[model samples]
Target: MTRYIAYIMCPALLCLYLTGCDFEDEYNVSPRRNFESLWKIIDENYCFFEYKNVNWDNIYSRYSPEIEEQMSDYDLFRIMSDMLDELQDGHVNLLSSNVGISSYDGWLNGYPSNFNTEVLRNTYWSRSQNYNDIVKHNRIVDNQIGYIYYGSFKESILEKDLDNIFSTFSYCKGIIIDVRDNGGGSITNSDRLASRFLNEKTLCGYIRHKTGKGHDDFSDPYPIYLTPSHGYLWLKPVIVITNRKCYSATNNFVSKMKVLPSVTILGGRTGGGSGFPFTSELPNGWSIRFSTSPILDVDKQHTEFGIEPDIEVDLTDEDIKENKDTLIEEAVRILLN
Candidate 1:
C-alpha cells in the first residue's frame, strides 16, 4: 500500500512541474511583449537592413526604452509604426485599429509633379476607343507612334487583348508604353507585357529571398529572363515613360525594358519598390508586412530608391500651360527622328 501511494504521487508531481514550465514558456500578451515580438520579426526577416545601412541593434536599443508593460495598445502601435519608418522603404507597413503606416513619404514627398492625368487624358486617351480597358493602345503622333497607357499592373492584360492592341498599332512608326503613377501589382502582368517587346530570350535582372532569420541570410540570386512573345512581338522602337509613382512591377518593367536594344525610358526617375513583401502578426493581432526579398537591376544593384531614366525629363510649367506634355513630346521626337 505504501508503494502504490508513492507511484501515484510521483506522476502527479511530474504533471504539475510540466504545467509550470509550459506556463513560463508562453509569453503573456502584453504591450511590451507585442512590441518586442514586432521588433524581432523585422530584425530577423527584413532584407534591406544592410543595403539601407541601418543598424538594427541600435534601433532596438533606441525604441525599447519607450515600451512599457502598462502602455496602451494605441500607444504601442504608434511606437512600432514609428520604429518601422526608420527603414525608409515604401514596402514596409504596419496596421492596427488605431494606426496605419506606409513608408512612402521618404521617396515621394515634395518631388516634382511630373504627371498630370487630366492633361494625358485630354490629349491622348480621349481619342482612344475602349479607353477604360486595363491596357489602352491608341495611335498618336498623327497615327505614327502607337501609345499604350497602363494605369496599374494590378489589372491583368489578357493575351487576346495584347493581340488586338498590337494588331491595331501594327503600322505605327514606334511605340510608347506609359506607366506613370502605377503603384505596381502583378509581376506576371509586367512579365506578360515585357514578353511582347522581346525578340529573343533576354537576361533582364535577378531576385533573391531570405533563407534564414538573419538580415543578410539570403539565397543565391536567380536570373530572371524574358522570352519573346510567341504571338505578337514588337520589333520596332519602343519608349517607356515613367515617373516617381512607377513602382513595384512597373519598376521591374522599366528595369528590364531599359536593357532592350529598341527601348528608351523617358520622364522622371521611377519610384522604386523592388522588395517582395511578406506579412506577420503581433501579439495584439495587428498585422505588419515587410519585404523579405530583394530585386536587383541588371547590374545587380538595389533599385529600392528609384531608377534613373536614360534621358531625364521633367514636365515643365511652361509646357503644361501650353497643353503639351514635355515627356510625351520628347518621346515622340525621339521616335520620329
Candidate 2:
C-alpha cells in the first residue's frame, strides 16, 4: 500500500510540473491573431480599397475559416498573397520570395544581393538562360567602353556602387549606360545617378503623381533631385543604352535625360514598368508593394507603357559571339560622328 501511494503521487507531481502556463502560452501562437494584425495594417495604410474601406469583413470571411482549419503557414500566406495581388501594382507585390523573407527576417533590410550584376564584361554574353536581374552587372567591352546594367531600384547597395562606377567614366570619350535589364529603383537614386552626366547643377525635375485624395480630385507631391557635386561631373557625350527591360525609375531617368541637349537615348521602346511602388505586408507573413505614385517624362507624360529610345537597335547572336554590343557600338558610332 505504501509503494502504490508513492507511485501515484509521483506521477501526479510530474503532470503538474509539465503543465505550466508558460509552455501552454508558447504553444498557442494564435494564427487568427496574426491574421487580424495584418488585416488592421492593410485597412489603415492601403492607399485605396474596394469600397473606399478595406473590406476586412470579406477578407476575414475568406481567410479565417481556412486558417482555423489548421492549414500550414505557407498555404495561409499564399492565400493572402493572391488576395493582395488583385491590387495590381508594383508596391503591392508579394515579397520577392519565401527564401528571401526567411533570410532577411523582414523587408526593411536590403533585398538579397542576387538581384543585379556589377562586373563589366570585355565581351557580350547571352542572358536568355537566366532571368534574375540582381546577379547581372554592368559589363564593358574593348576596355574603353562602359556598361551599367540595373535590375531595379529596391537594392540600396547597388545605388551606392553606381555613384562610384559612374565617376570612373570621366575620361571615356563616350559611355553606354546599358539599362537593358534594369527594371527600376528608387526614383531619387535614378536622378542622383543620372546627374553625373550633367555639366552643372540642375533640377532633375519633380517626380510627381496624384494620390486619390478624393475620387477624381487627386493630390500630388513632387519628388525632386539636384546634383550634389560641383566638379567630377562627366561632361562627355552620354549615350544611355536601353531596351524593353529599362523601366520604372530607370524609365523615369531615361525620360528626364532625353530632354538634356547633351544626352542621347538608344534602343527600342523600354519595358513598360514605370510607377512608384509603395509596400506593405500581408497576413501569413507575406509582403506586398503597390504603385501609389506615377513615373512621368520630362514633358510630364506618364511612362505606364514605357519610354521610347532615340535610336532603336537590336542585339543579334553574332554580336554576342564577337563580344560586341550592337547597341553600344552604335552609340559610339553616332557620338564619334
Index of the highest-lDDT prediction = 1
lDDT of 1 by residue, 145-216 (tens): 999889899998778878889998899989999898888998998999999987899999899999998887
Query: Candidate 2 regions off by >4 Å?
Result: 1-88, 96-171, 200-205, 208-217, 221-225, 282-285
TM-score quality measure for candidate 1:
0.90
Model 2 / residue 114 / CA error / Å: 20
Q: Whose TM-score is greatest here?
A: 1
Full-model lDDT, candidate 2 = 0.57
Question: Each model's TM-score?
Answer: 0.90, 0.59
What is the per-residue lDDT of model 2 for residues 15-65, given as tens digits with 9 covering 90 to 100? Answer: 888775445223233557656655555555454453234565576677766
Whole-model Cα lDDT of every candidate shown, in order: 0.87, 0.57
